[model samples]
Target chain A: MTSLTSLASSRTPADLLRTSATAVWIFLVVATVTSWALGTDHAFVDNTTAASVVVLLLAFVKVRFVGLYFMELKDAPLPLRALIEAWCLIVCALTVGFFLAG
Target chain B: MTSDVIDAPASPATAPGKKRRIPGEEGTWIFIFGDMCVFAVFFCVYLSARMADPAGFAHDQAELNQNFGAINTVLLLVSSLLVVLATRAVHSPALKRHAPRLLAGAWLCGAGFLGIKALEYAEKVHHGITPQTSDFFMYYFVLTGLHAFHLVLGLAMLTVLIRFASKPEMSRGQFIFFEGGACFWHMVDLLWLVLFPLIFLVR
Candidate 1:
């Protein structure tokens, strides 16, 4: 078993900014702005069920990005990754299902 | 300190024949997933309540300041990014010196989130919009209040992480603890990502 403290190192501060995490952060910010616009009164789109669904879907997608990237689950072992993916899908499906059913 | 002493995957390239690893202790995931399950129930209950009174819920949801929610989302995202960078720094010999500062930055971002949340709560109270105001407000207060409580815990964890970063070396046990704490912080951020839309955005 590889000890937790024995992992290899190759990244620097500059490399950190260029990593997948940074890219995900940018995407997350943009997605948040899009959701904000969709949810606000000033939105160009109508506040219909479709718009609401889009916003909810966008939120959950952002959640997945945070998990897979920021939480470092993207590089995690298969079982752990599978568990989180299942959580995201189940939660998102149930939440959306409830919204649509209403 | 040698790079071998730090914890976590700093390189994109894993060594040949090395097993894929989880980020933190196995027990940590149990708690993380359990807390998530509880919040999942909360989400469903809120949705069910909204279904019963859609019009009232939408009406009251309109009263929420979306700007506050958006800004808070940005704050949390920035904080999460900082935490990610700090964790990477922990794994790099040359970058380890930056870890404490990075964690401190994340702490500030978390503090900013709490500050904004406090302002939001105060504004609601100032306008006489307590939890008793409506079913919507009730869920809003309870859910966000619980989330804020979690954020407070995350901030405390960040403080610990900052201290950990300053240490010259960490034992395998300490590294596992650090990793688990980092995951907990990310869980807080993940919950808010869903909560923001569920409460503030969704019609």
Candidate 2:
């Protein structure tokens, strides 16, 4: 496995773009656009509940990506990583449940 | 880990041995997590209020400019990407020269976010909107306002980071401090990631 330190040592612009951090950035940007499309007034879908749920879930997922990749939590100690993961899951679940409950 | 251990070229944290390590100081993580918990409570409060008046909240949410929220999201994400790259550069001798520039770019992105947020707030006020407008606008202003305060702090942290990155050589303690600052900036981005959808998008 390529270590994060090694990935960060990437020299050129192409090498930089090919790094895992850049890959995660691309994923996050696409996810943001997806959430925007689904939840905005211009949304094609008619189901507000479904759209809201997806948007909320996507937001949390993006949060996790920022924590894991951008913040280097993926390379962190297991206990710390698990704690953050649990936080993400629990908060997301509660948000979804509350949204659906109403 | 002590500074000596961290300063070692073959430090377990960065070596190929794959020893697990926290990105920043343990105290920093504790503070980060604590701050997150507080925001989580804020989120729950907002949701509970929204549930009480879903129709009103949804109606007001529609009035928000999703474009501003989306653009701010992009700006923060890009800023975070720069910070991530800058953090990486800090760890590599060959790339170290670029760290200051990368951090500056991140700082610029943060400034862009603040600029857009100011415009958003002005526009809202121009249309006779304020925190006292309604429950929804109240939460919107309060939540985003608190978030903007954190962003300002993060920008200050980035300024310190740029100064540190400009140094020819950084002590391991300074490096750890840099990592901690970078993590804090990412936390700002993380909060906004949820705030955008919650306040602007979610019905």
Candidate 3:
């Protein structure tokens, strides 16, 4: 367990929470607008794929926001946070790798 | 006369006053983590199948309505913001009284998400594009169906938390648990953001 002092030493817990929410909202809005403008047509080719990739990257950023802020993983002991994030990343990598290869 | 053990002070192990650590929270996290892995595998399988039949997948993907997907994404992202606000309200003495209302707002947003998704699905099915129509359709139905299930569960958790919001026994820290559940639900929504464009909008 982490010390309360260390937890409080950084941005007050409330500030961190607010910052995370703001960050997630900005990310979502940006992705929505960009994808809409750029992906108006179902190109099915390289352009669409590029747009999709950008959206997916944005998804990754949003997930990080949720995990660190709402899930309170930022305040958790380092090992536990690493374990959770690492597993998710590995699975994600394997997924993309398998799909890209096939 | 034999002395009665009844109503007597219990042994150290059986002491009623001792706070036994509730294992429920930790166990729930494990369950959720496993659930995430299940989704991860599903995503992988969908991705691989899409790669294998890009042309067919592209054709099916074009049938989907990107507008609806975009709207639903906005709804969910907004709901996540509401949940975060609800958690903050729970912690703040000034706003503690409004926490349930904030949570209710979150649930309403979730319902809106489901409603939009329903309309989208209905329109798709009306156009003669069902899950059986193609491999892409299959992934679309399955992935979105899974997300719908999570949305329902998240709403249920919100309802439960709201019920206890006014109770004296509940503490501000209790909201963190609901916040975590909301986070997972948001992740479900966020995943669809990518899936929609990748599988539907992008064709």
Steric clash pairs (candidate 2): none
lDDT (10s digit) by residue, model 3, range B30-135: 7666777677678778878877887787677666777887788778777777776655554444445666887788889899989988998899888898989888
Docking class of 2: medium
lDDT for each residue of candidate 1 in A1-102, tens digit (9 for 90 to 100)? 112233244444675565767878899999999888888766789656788899899888888888888777877898888888998999999999999988
Determine the backbone clash count of candidate 2: 0
* Tens digit per residue, CA lDDT, model 1, B161-183: 99988998876666777888999
Please give me the DockQ of candidate 2 compared with the native complex: 0.65
lDDT of each: 0.85, 0.86, 0.63
Q: What range of 10 consecutive residues in model 2 chain A has the weakest lDDT sum?
A: A1-10
Once model 1 is optimally superposed onto the true structure by TM-score, how far is the C-alpha of residue B130 displaced, in angstroms? 0.8
lDDT, candidate 3, at B77: 73
Over 4 Å off in model 3, which ranges? A1-18, A42-46, A95-99, B1-24, B168-180
Candidate 1 Cα RMSD after full superposition onto the native fold (Å)? 3.5
Best candidate (score: DockQ): 2
Q: What is the TM-score of each candidate against the true structure?
A: 0.92, 0.94, 0.78
Off by over 4 Å in 2: A7-10, B1-14
Clash count of each predicted structure: 0, 0, 0
**On DockQ, who's better, 2 or 3?**
2
Between candidates 2 and 3, the one scoring higher on TM-score is 2
